[model samples]
Structure formats: C-alpha cells, structure tokens
Target: MSSATTYESTSSGHMCDMDRTPIRHAEAIAARNERDEVYAKEAKARELLRITKRKAEKTKLALRIAEDKVYKYRQALFLSWTVLGVYFVFSTVFGGHGHMQLHLP
Candidate 1:
C-alpha cells in the first residue's frame, strides 16, 4: 500500500509539470514573435528614411544645376547688349560724311 501511494503521488506531480510545460513554451513563443515584429518595423522605417534622404539630395543637385544655367545665360545676355551699344555709338559718330568737320570759307 505504501509503495502504491508513493507511486501515485510521483505520477500526479509529473502530470502537473507536464501540463505547465506547454503553457510556458507558448508564452515564450509569443514573446519572441512580438520581438520579431518590432524588429521588422524598425527595419522598414530605416529603409524609408534612406529613400527620403536620397530624394532630397537629388533635388538639391538639380536645383544647383538649374541655378548655374541661369547664371550663364544672364552673363551671355549682358555681353550681347554691351556689344550692340558699342556698335551703335561707333556707327553714329563715324558713318558717312564727317558731321563735325569745320568749313573755312
């Protein structure tokens, strides 16, 4: 009888431990899943940030190129106007018969 009682008690204890094992395993798996989800979100955010930064850099470069083109065009226009003005002055003063000649009778 004593041996039988000992055996029953040992079996019940083992059964209880067995019942708790699966619950513990489930909790651990849930915690790991949560951690993996957080890591995935962080990775996605980093990728988005990198893409945005690259676009901003491209835009800045494009703006600089446009500004450089505008500066060159303005310089060319100013040079053309100056040349035209000089040509007009020379033609008016020296073209055809001399306008400033003195006639001594």
Candidate 2:
C-alpha cells in the first residue's frame, strides 16, 4: 500500500534507484506487512492479559470487602451477646424479679 516515485534520466537512458538492494525489493514490503500482522496479534494478546489481570484484581477486592463485612457482623453479634450476659448477671446479683418486660412503640 505504498507508492514509490522514480525519476528516469532520459539523456543517459538510466533510472534512479532509491531502493536497489535485494532486501529492499517487493518481498521486503510483504515481509514488513507480515511483521506488522504479527505485532498486531502480540498487542492484542497483551491487551487481553491486562483485562484478565484487572478482572482478577476486582474479584480479590470484592472478596476482601465481603470478608470485612462478615468480620464486623460477627464482632457486633459477640458484643451484643456479652451485653446480654452482663445484664443477666447484674439482675441475678441484685435479686431482680424473674419477670420479663417488653416495650412497644
């Protein structure tokens, strides 16, 4: 997909050769195109890897957040149970009546 413009010397019956070597022939263009295709594939693979890594990171973050929530819930449950036990102990020691009270609003 490239255009090459060459000027011919009419007086000398010669042509200016900008790319004269065998390595710089039409085959070189095909080789360059093949190389570009390979490079494109490699770039695509790298992009996919980055996306996969990001997904894994997000999953890990979500798991950590969930663990923290569960830990907090357990701590709260333990604290409430301890408070209930303390209340029961104080009532028994003070000889409180064994009557239950419920308040509704």
Candidate 3:
C-alpha cells in the first residue's frame, strides 16, 4: 500500500494520468508493487551470489595453503630419511668390521 499524494484518490485508490493514458488505480498500484517486488528479489539474489563467491574464494585459499604445507612436510621427511640412511651406511662400513675408508670427490 502506497500513499495517494496525487490528490486524485477515489473510494478505492489513487488515480493519476500516466503518459497521457488513463489507467485503473488498482492496476497502477499493482504494477508498481510488482516492480518493487522484482527489484527486491533481484537485489537479494545478487547479494547471495556475492557472498557465495567470497566463501568459495576463502575456501580455495585455505585448501591451497594446506596443500603447500603437506608438500613441504613430505619433502622434509624425505630429506631426513636420506640423511639417516647415509649416516647408518658410513657408520656400518667403517665400524672396524669392514674397515673401509672414504675419499672425497
């Protein structure tokens, strides 16, 4: 329901001359109300789309960070295993049972 500030309201609703065409007061109000409803729905939909996009972006960023951390963890694990293996090999080879000597390249 809107105001009848046009000073042409009857017993039912407001009346005004629109584009040189006479229209029913109820029809005019209904058209205006329908347009308002459409605009509101569109605005709400756009807001929802924007929020969803933002959430997706944040989720993607978090996933990328987690993947990077896992990759670094795997690399470090491999390096530690390699170093330990080398230490054990040198210790066993030179531990008096084998009596091996190493020459640097």
Candidate 4:
C-alpha cells in the first residue's frame, strides 16, 4: 500500500525485493542526454565546415595569383634577354665595339 520505491536486502548483503520504477527513470534520463549531445555536435560540425570552405577559397585565390606572377616574370625575363642579344648583334656589325665591322663595296 506504499507509493514509494523500496529495496530489501538478504542475509548475504545482496539486494532482494527492489522496485524497478527508479531504474527505468535513470535509463530514460541517460538516453535523453545522449540525444541532446548529438544535437550539440551537429551545430559544431556545421561551423567547422563553413570555416573550412572559407579557407579553401582563400587558398585557391592565392595559388592563382602566384601562378600569374610567375608567368609574367618569366615572360619579361625572356623579352629582356632577347633585346640584349639584338643589341649585341647590332653593335658588332656596326663597329660600335671595334671587334667586327661590315664594309660595302
């Protein structure tokens, strides 16, 4: 005739007659906490994904700029070398260096 949970022990110090309502309540509380943990992790995962996308975009743009700069520098170096070669050839043929000359007959 009692509404409260009770536990009885035997002579060997082991539990005997015990009520199960408290056990079920404890299991339910644990399950609810586990469900809440999943929700919390979902929000954290979304934030991490967003940050990763931003970093990838920045890295992609930096790589493109670096490639463009290298191409321009390489082209300019080739042009400078070509101009120097032409100047040397003209100087030799016109007697500017006095090493060689062209005579017209």
- Give the clashing pairs for model 3: none
Q: Which stretches of candidate 3 lie over 4 Å from their true place?
A: 1-23, 96-105
Task: Give the candidate number with the greatest lDDT.
Answer: 4
Give the Cα RMSD of candidate 4.
6.9
TM-score of the candidate numbered 1?
A: 0.65
Q: Superposing all C-alpha atoms, what RMSD in Å does each candidate have to the true structure?
A: 8.0, 8.8, 9.3, 6.9
9-84 per-residue lDDT for model 3 (tens digits): 6567545455225447777988999999999999999999999999999999999999999999999999999999
- Best-to-worst ranking by TM-score: 3, 4, 1, 2
Stronger candidate by TM-score (1 vs 4): 4
Judged by TM-score relative to the true structure, which candidate is superior, 3 or 4? 3
**Model 4 C-alpha lDDT versus the unseen true structure:** 0.84
Q: What lDDT score belongs to each candidate, Candidate 1 first?
A: 0.83, 0.82, 0.81, 0.84
Give the runs in model 2 whose Cα sits over 4 Å from its true position: 1-30, 99-105
Lowest-sum lDDT 10-residue window in model 1: 3-12
Q: How do all models score by TM-score?
A: 0.65, 0.59, 0.67, 0.66
lDDT, candidate 4, 1-105, per-residue tens: 332334665567765435665687888999999999998999899999999999999999999999999999999999999999999989978878765556669
lDDT of 2 by residue, 3-79 (tens): 23555453566644554554477789989999999999999999999999999999999999999999999999999
CA error at residue 40 for candidate 3, angstroms? 0.7
Off by over 4 Å in 4: 2-19, 98-105
Candidate 3 C-alpha error for residue 30, in Å:
0.9
